[model samples]
Target: MLEIELLGVKMKNPTMLAAGVMGSTAASLNWVSCSGAGAVVTKSFSKMPNKGYKNPTTVEVTGGIINAIGLSSPGVETFKKELESINEEVPKIASIYGASPEEFSQVAGEIEQIVDLIELNISCPHAMSGCGAAIGQDPQLTFDVVEAVKKSVSVPILVKLTPNVTDLPEIALNAQKAGCDGLTLINSLGPGMKIDLETGRPILSNRFGGMSGPAIKPIAIRCVFETYAVADVPLIGVGGISNYHDVVEFLYAGASAVQIGTAIMNHGPEIFAQICQGLEKFMEEHGFQSVNEMVGLAHQF
Candidate 1:
């Protein structure tokens, strides 16, 4: 009942392992697959190597944690080896980032044949200055990056968007116009920070980073609810998902599927199997026949 197919890629369930969680290597990606994620998105990699932020890259906050991992990637060339090593039957999505359209295309093209899909990481709040949210927050740049990647690879493209935007629909529509196959909404919430009272210094080495956890679920639901109304393509709901109820909320809010990130830090890869069990029970109790029945139900009322 939890099975889903997004943009021609089939998944056994709606829960995807969100990028930047335990997605950096073939070992971890395969681990999530074996653990039961419908699909796994690799940590965002760039065309060039990036060491990312220094020590203290993550700090716990009240509702969630703030992270400034800075999209540290070993670059596409090296990342290709990890992609090739993945042996799971479940779909694999490569999350890639770049400073410009050409760079985005270069990375996408390099990994196109290895992964099932490409998720454009134009939405990382803590990414390097010129990349990440910089491309996603603007309508034209989002278009340019998606368009460039679409031209470079035959694999479907899913553009991950930032909730930090002033108008989410504007960027969502722009990505659709650029021919992206689908969208991943709300990549974390804030470039939020925590300060140390003892030293009067910021906790994270990068000073601030995007926020993710239970606190951002409402905004993520809002983004999915709002974008589903205007977007023609499928929506992949992410951010702050911890349980099957949260998955139901995103599906009700109009997401065809959902991705889990920070929750994994506390729950471990076992969270995937746990959520699938909970989701299956929830579906049976609610009288839903399939995951598709729950999509966009909020818009009906």
Candidate 2:
């Protein structure tokens, strides 16, 4: 009853594991699949391995977490082995990033045959200079990267967008015009930061990282809400989703599927089954027969 299809990929349920959280290896991705997530997105990797930031990469705040994991990755060659091992029953999405359109397309073309979908990581708030939000925030760069990847790979290309932009609709439209198959809204809310009360210094080594969890759900939903109106492709919502109610909200906000990241840190992979169960009950009680029927319902008014 909860089945959903995004960019021609079939998902048994609407829940997917957001990239960068237990997505670095086959074991962890498979574990999430076993735990009931409909699909799994690999941690964002690049052409070359990145050591990422030093210690204190992640810090906890009131409503969610601040992470500057720096998009640490093992590089595509090594990551492909892990991608190949993912269970076929679960849809595996490879999240990759690069500094230019050529680099992005190279990585996508290399791994497109191994994964069901390719998520371009142009929106990481904490990525190093010349990458991450720097590319996504610019319409021309965003268009170039999406167009290049689309040209290189036959598989679906999903451009993950940064919420830090002033006008998300413009960016969304650009991506759609560039031939992207889908969109993933709101990577993280900030170059947000925290402080050490005792040390009187910044908490994370990177000084600033993306803010996630419940604190960002409202904005994530708003991005999905607004982008859905402008984007020609399907939307995948990611932000502060923590419960079944949050999942329902994303669907109402126009997301074809919802991804869980920070919530996994607090709730564990088991959260998938719990959310699916709760969502099923809620749907039964609400008299909704399919997840697609509930999508974008909130925009009706």
Clashes of 2: 1
lDDT of 2 at 274: 96
Per-residue lDDT for 161-184 in model 2, tens only? 999999899999999999999899
Give lDDT for model 1.
0.92
Q: Write the per-residue lDDT of candidate 1 for residues 206-268, one digit (tens) a residue.
A: 999999999999999999999999999999999899999999999999999899999999999
User: Whole-model Cα lDDT per candidate?
Assistant: 0.92, 0.91
Error of 2 at 277 (Å): 0.7
- Each candidate's number of clashing pairs is 0, 1
How good is model 2 by TM-score? Answer: 0.98
Give candidates' CA RMSD values in order.
0.9, 0.9
Clashing pairs in 1: none
